[model samples]
Target: MAAARESLLDAAGAALARRPWPAVRMVEVAAAAGVSRQTLYNEFGGKDGLARALVRRAADGYLAGVERALAGNGGDWERLTAVAEWTAAAAQEDALVRALLTGCWSERLPAPPRGPAPVPAQRRPEPPLPSPPDLVRIVRDRAVTALSGPGTAPAATVELARSCELVVRLALSCVTAPPGEGGIAGLIRTAAPRTAL
Candidate 1:
């Protein structure tokens, strides 16, 4: 069943790459996945439900990358820079990641403007999984636990955790709006306080 669901998601992703989600019909996704329309409905309930699942899966991938970057050998700041770079680059490449990072529905679909005055509310994409800010907090909390050593002072640990949160937030901000000059590394250095570390 899980394999079937994954196959369907893969099919949906391919279809999304070719065109907008609004144009992706259930029958077509079913055909691409070699599954019946009823099976697709049973697996995902409907199109919106499938959209939520796809976003959730993509968010999970982003979080996994964060964990890997944080766990890598280096000082906290170095790990954060790695995370920032990864997120910035990934946002540019992955539509789902960009949607979650930017909180923009348009990134999840193909372009050229659809319909009349405004797009429908139901068609707009929602980050049904963890938002970028939430992901930052999760990374911050994990960093606190990992960075707290046997002899580390409690005050220092608190400061380190706050630093982690700030760096992660800065990275996310870069992902959302992308600075004209400074880039992720430079942005991280400038945003991090002199006292924070």
Candidate 2:
């Protein structure tokens, strides 16, 4: 079952890579994966479910990249800098990541009409909103684990977490920025630690 789920996800990603999200249909995905539509439905409920899974998978991959960057052999400050650069590069390079960041195709589908809806009014309390990623938590955990060697300072840990938040925001901004403007590298340089020499 897990193998089938993974195969469906892989097929969906491949289809997404070839074209925009609107072009990706469940029938095509099932055919690509050599599975029935029922199997895809069972694994991922529907298109929205698949999209959420894709976004979650992309988030996990991005966090892993951040972890690798934070593991570089350097002081906490340098590791944080590396993480900023790596995150910017990853967001800029990945198509799936770009889609997630930019919200492409997400606005095309209108919300279901409210009139004569299937459920009774009493039973239809507002659905819970999806929470944004806990990027700060992820980064802080990675920084603490990677930089907690003998000489690491407590202040440095806080600084790394602060820097991670700034860097991640800047990376996301770059993804959504206009094409002609300078990129996150400029933002990172502006926010870079000052040297006292």
Candidate 3:
């Protein structure tokens, strides 16, 4: 079953690569996968479900790449550089990642507006939007893993993790940004504090 699900996802991704998300019909995906429409629906409820799964799968690949880069020999700076470089490259190479970053797919198939149409609500509006990408949490988790070991200094470990996070986020932003913008190295110098040096 898992293999079948993965096969469906692979089919979806390949289709997406060839055309815009809006043009990608379930029937086409089913045909490409040699599965019935019902089977596609069973695995992924609809287009939105399939898109979400694609994004999640891409994210998993990115995180794995970062982990592999970190595992190689280097100090914090070198490892951070590796993570940044790998992430940028991955984002560039990944169709789904580009789709999410640019909202190319989501914009093509936007969700319907919430609340009653042509009716104003009396209740207070919802809270402000959340920040992008939850960098703090990702950084903290990576830092803990990288710094926790025998003979590792607590302060240095924290610093290294902080540096890594800064570099990684910077790289992500650059690779994901619209064309004509500069790369991650520019963002790194600006975001990382002097104390982090």
The most accurate candidate by lDDT is: 1
Evaluated at residue 109, the lDDT of candidate 2 is 26
Clashing pairs in 1: none
Candidate 2 lDDT, tens digit per residue, 119-143?
Answer: 3232332332222354546665676
Candidate 3, residues 60-136: lDDT per residue as tens digits? 67667768776779765556667777767876798555443333445443232233222113323332211235433
Superposed model 3: Cα runs more than 4 Å off: 99-131, 176-197
For model 2, the stretches where C-alpha displacement exceeds 4 angstroms are: 99-133, 149-156, 176-190, 194-197
Across residues 1-197, which tens digit of lDDT does each residue of candidate 1 receive? Answer: 77888999999999998988888898999899999998888776788667767777877888788778878998867777787787777777888888777667684463322223221333444333665566667778876676566888888887888887877777777776786686778877877863655
Q: Higher lDDT: candidate 1 or 3? A: 1
- Whole-model alpha-carbon lDDT for candidate 2: 0.63
Looking at candidate 3, what is the lDDT of residue 44? 65
Number of colliding residue pairs in model 1: 0
lDDT against the true structure, per candidate, is: 0.74, 0.63, 0.62
User: What lDDT score goes with residue 88 in model 1?
Assistant: 79
TM-score of each: 0.79, 0.67, 0.70
